[model samples]
Target: MSGKDTGHGTQRLALPGVFTAEQAAVTAAAIAGIQRADGAIPWFRGHHLDPWDHIEAAMALDAAGDHRRAAAAYHWLARHQLPDGSWYAAYADGDATRPTDRGKETNFCAYVAAGVLHHYLATGDEEFRERMWPVVYAAVEFVLELQREGGEIGWRRDPDGSACDGALLTGCSSIHQALRCALALAELRDDPQPDWELATGRLGHALRHHPECFLDKSSYSMDWYYPVLAGALRGAAGRARIEDRWPEFVVEGLGVRCVSTNPWVTGGESAELALALWAVGDSERAARVLRWIGHLRAPDGLYWTGYVYADEAIWPRERTAWTAGSVLLAVAALTGDEATGAVFGGAGLPRGLEAEECCDRS
Candidate 1:
């Protein structure tokens, strides 16, 4: 399907009997509404411009047939990126903003490479790929510099060049996927990538076997499923890890929680869980995860930030761009649909040594 073809896009992937055509139209319109005229997408209604969340919402826009806007959003990131291959933690509208003088976040910085790669794939724009390569290369270098002794990546870099000691399993896992995508892009363009290969392998090894080396944020849904979803975990062991935590983190028809005990279920986590479940060959379970969040949809096709457990009303009571994007991605995965094949289509799992082979073999 061409990028211009809107008929088979995200609109059609909505849950059966769940979202109507009118609802999907509202959702698409809502996404478009958050997009700035300059092509940047904000996370919420007003001036909330976060890079990671913005890229995520842009991906959804591409899925919904807004490639021009998605490309513009990427261009905006390129324009704003620091020379050291990082962005501030946050940005205020029409002004450069930063919480600290920090250079870049490991997770947030790594994510844009995937977004660029996705844009290239969806649109097949060679010029865009060429323009984006420098950004991808520089960002990967920044991430590699922060890698710790045991192969795990640090969380973020302070402006003074100091690193956060604790690593997050979820963050590293996402970076692993980004690294692979970067490597793939490098190879596609016939560029040399020996360093990328080595770094990617090391990071993948850390994710597969060295959870102890990272911060123990295992109580969260991201930590639970990111290994699988991020393409860092594979085979029998990967399957086992997901199965072990499945019951603990999932709350039946409600959705997945940010933390297992948080009593708040969110669209992003639920959709992410669906992607992870699909990776492990559990389409039935993946579909269930998607369905769990279907009811969270607002009349505008957007979703509330999260669902409150007590009243079951939407908590934060605000529609979120990323939340709607998450639902679109989950629905795409569940329905075997792809508005843009570039959007992380279940590329099996990461290649090379299994978790057991990496950790236990003599």
Candidate 2:
């Protein structure tokens, strides 16, 4: 609320014990420092921009009470949206808006809806929501255009416009959550997208039952937990899913591993798992998981990407906006930020149209 007007009334983000007010402010400042004048937030100051991470950082900025900047970040996305409603996989360096990776990632395209809705929820910014609706709607169309008949969305589209043959568990799960947010936006506008709802329900079915549709990536922590975090799986089933992979992905007294074979425990993944845990009504476990990652926090309140257990050091010394952003989001969810809580805990967001059947065997 302290920030300049973005044509929408200003409102501050919720601050809870997820981190002290001081620590939260410090993290916010750190994030703000990396935001480009054009509103692009790269992974690090000199690093490239991925749309998903860019939005993550923007959300953190919003949580930190930098409302105008957060709104600017969304505007950046709207300004740069490709003709096809997608963005290149990566935009290199803040110095220019060039794409480092020209591939259009499916989940990355879909994520804009989640970001737009979260911003609207936090600020009650009707104008912001209205302006960004076309961007969100187009991004959703781009994502679902690649969804297969079996209900799994293809993972990416190459520069030449060919879709990737296989789906990814993590990416598809995230898209499921994004699709729900898109539905919520559509409903809010009184312009329901039945196709989106059906696609979402089908995508959810694929995420929960058709593992075969996605490339097998059991070793990666994201594949193990994102379904729960993304709301594709919930209740006892969700809790059981995390328990099923707990031993493989979580490092006791440390944090969640980036991969089963790696000695690395990543702050982003760990914080995300904490959010997932909270979504399933396991707040205590979520807090413990989040606390374990404090080891990855830098003196400046910025979080390191991961800690390498074998090296006994932060493997990637660089502080990433997304890593800090994940922590802020997890804390927001824990501290009861209604929008953050609703997004992560799968409340308030549309649940999508239930598929006629759970799984399409064909």
- Cα lDDT of candidate 2 equals 0.85
| Candidate 2 C-alpha lDDT tens digits along 1-362 | 22443222212323333466767777888887888989889998778999999999988777666788899889999999999999998988743457889999999999999899888888898889999999999999999999999899999999888987899999999999999989989989999798888898888877888889989888999998899999988999999999998998999989999999999999999999999999999988888888888888898879989999998988887999999999988887877778788778876778776775433423
RMSD of candidates 1 onward, in order: 3.3, 3.1
Candidate 1 lDDT, tens digit per residue, 144-210? 8888777789988877777867899999998888887787778778886776676777788788777
TM-score attained by model 1: 0.89
Each prediction's TM-score versus the true structure: 0.89, 0.94
> Any runs in candidate 2 off by more than 4 Å, and if so which?
1-18, 357-362
The ten-residue window of minimal lDDT in model 1 covers 1-10
- Write down the TM-score for model 2: 0.94
